[model samples]
Target: MIYKRLEFKNMAGQKVKITEIPVLDSRNPHYFLVHARLQALAAFIYNNPDSKTSYSFHDYLKRKMKWSDFIQLYRTEQYSHNA
Candidate 1:
């Protein structure tokens, strides 16, 4: 859940008011169901660090994803579709 509030401030020599931003809590329902899998995801991350996977993302993607995936992700900001 998030709480919204209003705030007042002085900007450019003028007094201005703005709506306060909402706070995001990881414990929320959606977050808990989705993004809150931090531990599992962390394990997954640690399980497949540096684009390397032990058992292979498939068998093909592993060997290919190892260094090449890192390269693709780093240079192109995307995973190789082939991998």
Candidate 2:
């Protein structure tokens, strides 16, 4: 999931830092976690079956939902192979 492991300037021309931490979430079932900047947004991380590459996307929920609802939806969503 990490393309490069070095600190570099971001698009804003400011120095950005990169740190790699080994984190595991059993409830998520995925090897990694996908976090969204906004609570109202839904985030997903998808791993390609045939490659080391993975794809991800984030989108706003159709309607305002509770945290439990979001978790339930994510668990049922197609993108996540996790239970």
Candidate 3:
């Protein structure tokens, strides 16, 4: 998600900078809106229940998403959750 209070370690075991994390959508390049990030993160978590903090949604969706469609998907999910 937005990782509001993040403090994760990177692959090299160095502390990760919050800026290194992206929201997995090219349209929302830098980061997704808080709520959208939350929903996407939730779906990812559900699908990968056994995983720990080893992967990011950005990593998973980078190739699966087109910039425009990704935005639409995220917005739709957000609306449904809050609707």
User: All candidates' TM-scores?
Assistant: 0.24, 0.22, 0.29
Candidate 1 per-residue C-alpha lDDT over 14-60 given as tens digits, one digit per residue, 9 for 90 to 100 = 32222222244656433332223333433444444342222222232
Model 2 C-alpha lDDT per residue in residues 1-83, reported as the tens digit of each score: 23222243433444433233223354753332333322112112111122222212222332344566545545533556664
Q: Which scores better on lDDT, 1 or 2?
A: 1
Candidate 3, residues 8-59: lDDT per residue as tens digits?
A: 4544444432232434445554345534654565554544444265445544
**Residue 53 C-alpha lDDT in model 1:** 24
lDDT of 3 at 16: 32
Between candidates 2 and 3, the one scoring higher on TM-score is 3
Compute the lDDT of residue 35 as modeled in candidate 3. Answer: 42
Q: Worst ten-residue run, lDDT, model 1? A: 51-60
Candidate 1, superposed: residue stretches over 4 Å from native: 1-23, 52-83
Best by lDDT: 3
> Model-by-model lDDT, in order?
0.34, 0.33, 0.47
Off by over 4 Å in 3: 1-19, 23-38, 46-48, 67-83
Error of 1 at 1 (Å): 12
